[model samples]
Each structure stands twice: as structure tokens, then as C-alpha cells.
Target: MISNLNEPDFIFLLKSGDTSAYQQLITVYKKTVYNTCLNLLQNSEDAEDICQEVFVTVFQSIHQFKGESKLTTWVYRIAVTKSLDYVRMKKRKKRFGFMRSIFSEESNEPIYDRPNFIHPGVLLENKERTEILFRAIDQLPENQKTAFVLNKLEQLSYVEVAEVMEVTVSSVESLLFRAKQNLKKILGDYYKENEK
Candidate 1:
């Protein structure tokens, strides 16, 4: 559907509230957005929810899109922001749960435990290695994690990643460098601990 329309035409139709244009945009971008959310959130359900929310946001905010970046870049930025917001909310909820447990008459143990996150796109042969990599990624600081995921998993170019992250291409490069270094250290520690 989107193949028929050029960027300007699509954006114009989308901004004019054309439902068909919106549907075409969704058909074109749903998988990319969903994958981005899943890699960042590491939870399928949350990723799905965030994916839908990202589209809703794009539809509502189409008028504000300044065309400074490519449409895909803009969409990627929204997906990343929504995913991070979900993670922050989850962290806050966990903290609240811990506080509630401490004051409750019941045992002081926290109730919620995050389930293991296995990305749906991972191949059977690479699952173990990917899981280890994801664990290391989960430990990264937020900016490093975003840079790593966008550059490595999503295969976005440095320029595109910079556009999504709202930083310069060199900053994206530095973030990726730091992310890789941190991952190497983390994975090295994990391997040594397991080897012992």
C-alpha cells in the first residue's frame, strides 16, 4: 500500500486525516516498530501494547511532524521513546511494590518478578548466545542500550540512529563504542563466573 505513495504524498494524506493513508503507514511500519519495542522492552506483551501506542501517537501528532527527518526515522524515535517510557513505568511500579510490601502485615517480600525475555526473532541455533547478550544489554545504562539496540539489532545507519536519538552521528558512534565495550566486560565477567 505504501509502495504506491511517495513520502510527501503519504505525509500529506496522513496529515489530512486520510484513514487509508494511516492504514498504509501502519502496514509498512508495524513490524519495524514492534521489533524495536520488543528489543528494548524485552517483553512481548508490553512491546505489542507500546507498538499500538506508537502508531496512535503518530496518527494524532502527524500535523506536528516537521519533515526534518525521514518518516521512518521519526517513527523510530517515537517507538524508542514509548519503549523507554514503559520501562520507566515498570521500574516505578516495582519500587512502589517494594514500598507497599515493607508496610504490609504480610511477609515483606516483593511480589512481582520479571519473566525471562526471549526475543521472538531469535533463531533456535542462536538462542542461547542471544539470551546471554540480551542479559548483558539489560544491564546497560539507558542511552547505551538505545544506541546498541538501534545500531546493532535494528541495523540502522549511524546517521539514522543519530536522527532517532536526536544526537550527532559522532555521538551515536561514541555511544555504540561505549556500549560494545561495556557489553564485552559484562559478558567476560559472566563467562568467567560460569566457567568457575
Candidate 2:
């Protein structure tokens, strides 16, 4: 059904409030959007929630989508933006929770608990390594993490990543370079601590 609908037509229908077209769009891009969210978020539940939120946002804002870039690129940009927002919110909540604990009569709880994030698509043998990698990725600055996930995990070209990120390809390259360096340092420290 998606293959039968060309990009321009699909955009037209979506903007005109065609329900079938919207459903088709969701069906066609759901997995890609979900995976993109999951790779950034690590938690399956949060990713799933954000995936729906992305579509809702796009649907509500479809009229604002000028035809400058491919629809997929625009959608990727939305997914990345929404995912980063969610991460920032979580961090803020964690900090707020700590502050509340300091002022409250209740005992202090563990402020940072690493979530058990098992990416559904990962193979059994690679799951452990992937989890460790995700932990390190979570610590990265937002731009580096976004670049790394979109370029390496989602297999998007640097050009595509740049378009989605609204940055130059050189900037994407720099982000990936820094992301790799940071990940190596983080994973190295993690291993050293675990080995002792």
C-alpha cells in the first residue's frame, strides 16, 4: 500500500486530513521511527511511547512541513527531537527527585538506577555488548549521541544525518568522531571497574 503511494501524493493526502493516508504513513514508517527512538532512548517502553508521540506531532503539524527535504528526513528529525526532549525531561526529573529527597523526611533512595534495556532486535550473542554500548551512548552529549545513532545504528548516510540534524556534514563527522572517543573512554572505565 505504501509503495503504491508516491511521496507528493502521500504528503498531499496527509495534509488534506486523509485518514487512510495517515494510517498508511504510520504503517510504512513505524518500525523505522520506533528503532530510531529505541536506539536513542535505550528503554523499549519509552521508545514505544515516543514513537506514538512523534506521529501525533507530525500529524498535528503536517501543514508546516515545507517540501525542502524528504518526508523521511523530516520524520527522522522529529523523532530525534522528541527523543532528546524525553531524555532531558528524565534527567530533570531525576535531579528534582534528588532535591526533593534532600528536603523530605523519607530516606534517600538510589538516585541513579541503570535501566535494563534490551533492544528487541539485537541478537542473543550481541545483547550483552549492545547493552554495554548503550550505557556508554547514554552518557554522551546530545549532538554526539544523535549523530552516532542516526549514522551508525540507523544506517543513514552522513548526508541524511546532516539533513535531519540541520547541520553540515562536517559537523556530523565531528560529532561522530567525538562520540566514538567518549564511548571508548566510558566503556574502558566501565570494564576496568568491573574487572577489579
TM-score against truth, every candidate = 0.94, 0.94
Give the lowest summed-lDDT range of ten residues in model 2: 107-116
Give per-residue CA lDDT, model 2, range 67-125, as digits (tens): 89999999999999999999899889889888878988885566764486777888999
Clashing pairs for model 1 are none
Q: Residue 69 CA error for candidate 2 (Å)? A: 1.0
What is the per-residue lDDT of model 1 for residues 1-196, given as tens digits with 9 covering 90 to 100?
3677789889999999999988889999999999999999998888899999999999999999989889999999999999998899998988888888888888567567667677777899998888888989999999999999999999999998998999999999999999999999999999999996
Q: Count the backbone clashes (under 3 Å) in each candidate.
A: 0, 0
